[model samples]
Target: MTEERNSLKEFFNYLRHHDLKMETVPLKEQKDYQHPDDDVDFHAYRILLLIFICGILKPTFFDNFTIYGRGKFSFYDFLIRYPFYLEKALRIKNKEDKIKDLEIKHYETEEAFSPMIRYIRGPWDHKYPDILNYMVSKNLITVHYSYFNKSQKAFCITLTDLGLETAQKIQTEEPIWTKRMEAINAIFRKDAQNQTIEMFVREHFSTLILGNAGE
Candidate 1:
């Protein structure tokens, strides 16, 4: 743990060299940093969060997040797995029903899945499915599934084995930076629309895990 702490300190030192205005240690005890419930939300990706926050501050950013996001690898991962939007029309009369059925059978036999998917955003949540599919196609995740919604659009999902393995490897075998990266990505995926979380991270965090985001 001491080695981990020192590495984090050095990461901040490097960031300072890069001209980022991150404040250093303050006159506070470790207890002060801990919440009563030990539950403090953290923010690790400012640029990515900006993708959604730009929306709240400026609507044009929201459209860009969806439209321009089409080209982003993350977004493409969300697209490929389940619905295959390019082939959507001829696919199925009740896609949701079909996917849920598959999920049940898939879960029954599969013992493990890529943990990375769980560490990141989601299986499918309207806009997220597209990004999730992109991750799968890139082999960043193992599987993805989608079901129909009120608009007859796909809504549900299933993840693949590779996804779980990635998550497990990061959470266990990788160094602290990798673990924190996983944690950070997890936070952003949970909510990109809020900047309040980012503010808190900026104010409270004196260190950041700088190891590879994931390796």
Candidate 2:
């Protein structure tokens, strides 16, 4: 029994030191990390569908005096950040069983690598500007810019006829994606109607938007 115990201790010592000291190599830095949703075509198609479902307007345009005066899904501010919010919404495990399939597996994977970084206003993705530019080059959408205030400029994005047609086809062909868009739209509409968008963001996205305020 003493010999057996000594053998076990020796085995554990081997595991704790020499066995664990097998050659180590430094991990190579990935200079350009690519996310699955980094595909411009994919984002363009999704944004087209979103604009079709929600319509066009500057997201920052809000009237404080009137209650629920703006059109539904017209806020471009929310549209710009929609992908991040959509991913968050889809990742909720407690959602109804009917929409359980909307939980995209890859979104979680993408978040693992290239999670949204907080910006001045909210969470910002690096791919949005490129996707918008690609859409414009393809004539999928049109942008109109105007001055919102003395120092600020506002832009409204609308789909071209081609964009509209393409968005329609996507809506018809991708039923699951269409449902996801509807769910996101409903969430935004509820927040907008209740004038609780700020509160909702604070509650749901506090980590991303509020956690790093000091930094």
Candidate 3:
């Protein structure tokens, strides 16, 4: 267990050194970091958005928490709202208020997913196929497919050990470790998917590099 913990610490250090730390607070709180402009932030935002979506789909620490947002998946808002708000800010859209309103409705009213998934700049960035292709190219995941499409309004993909390893590499350095041991204990103790996911989420904002619950 100690060795495993050390390995994860090393991975987090590597990612932080490479400036690839993907959490919201760390990015914003970095002293030397300059705010990214439109195009750059868009790509970054897309990546975080994917992580957030995948995080929510899993059973997480926030599953039982109540969210005050008035959105489509607001029931899932405990997991959804922060990511949506983060994306909205990163986009620097002039229609901020309108966007918020729509996001609320986006999850609430649509039996199917909102069309915004298509807002990805490239077709390759829109759904699961694209994610799988990227992961394969980067050696984070592997799959065989000629084409990809949405299913039940969610993308279907598989995770590799590499991906799982990658997720465990990230570390939390904010608000101290006051609540983390509790969160981690909950994570390891829970056999239930929904309960475990909510626990996993309390410590990490969005990194689904870990295994999926339902799969």
Per-candidate Cα lDDT values, in order, are 0.31, 0.55, 0.33
lDDT of 1: 0.31
- 1 versus 2: better lDDT goes to: 2
Stretches of candidate 1 above 4 Å error?
1-158, 182-215
Off by over 4 Å in 3: 1-115, 118-128, 143-155, 171-215
Weakest ten-residue segment in model 2 by summed lDDT = 63-72
Clash number for model 3?
12
Q: Every model's Cα RMSD, please?
A: 21.4, 11.1, 21.5
Candidate 2 residue pairs in backbone clash: 59-75, 59-76, 59-77
Question: What's model 2's overall lDDT?
Answer: 0.55
Per-residue alpha-carbon lDDT of model 3 for 1-215, expressed as tens digits?
99999999999999989989565656657666453322333232233322222332232322211111111112122222233533332234233433433333445433322222211111112333454355566654433321222321212233345544443342232211212222222223222233333443333432322333231
Q: Which rank order by lDDT, best down to worst?
A: 2, 3, 1
lDDT winner among the candidates? 2
How do all models score by TM-score?
Answer: 0.21, 0.53, 0.25
In order of TM-score, best first, we have 2, 3, 1
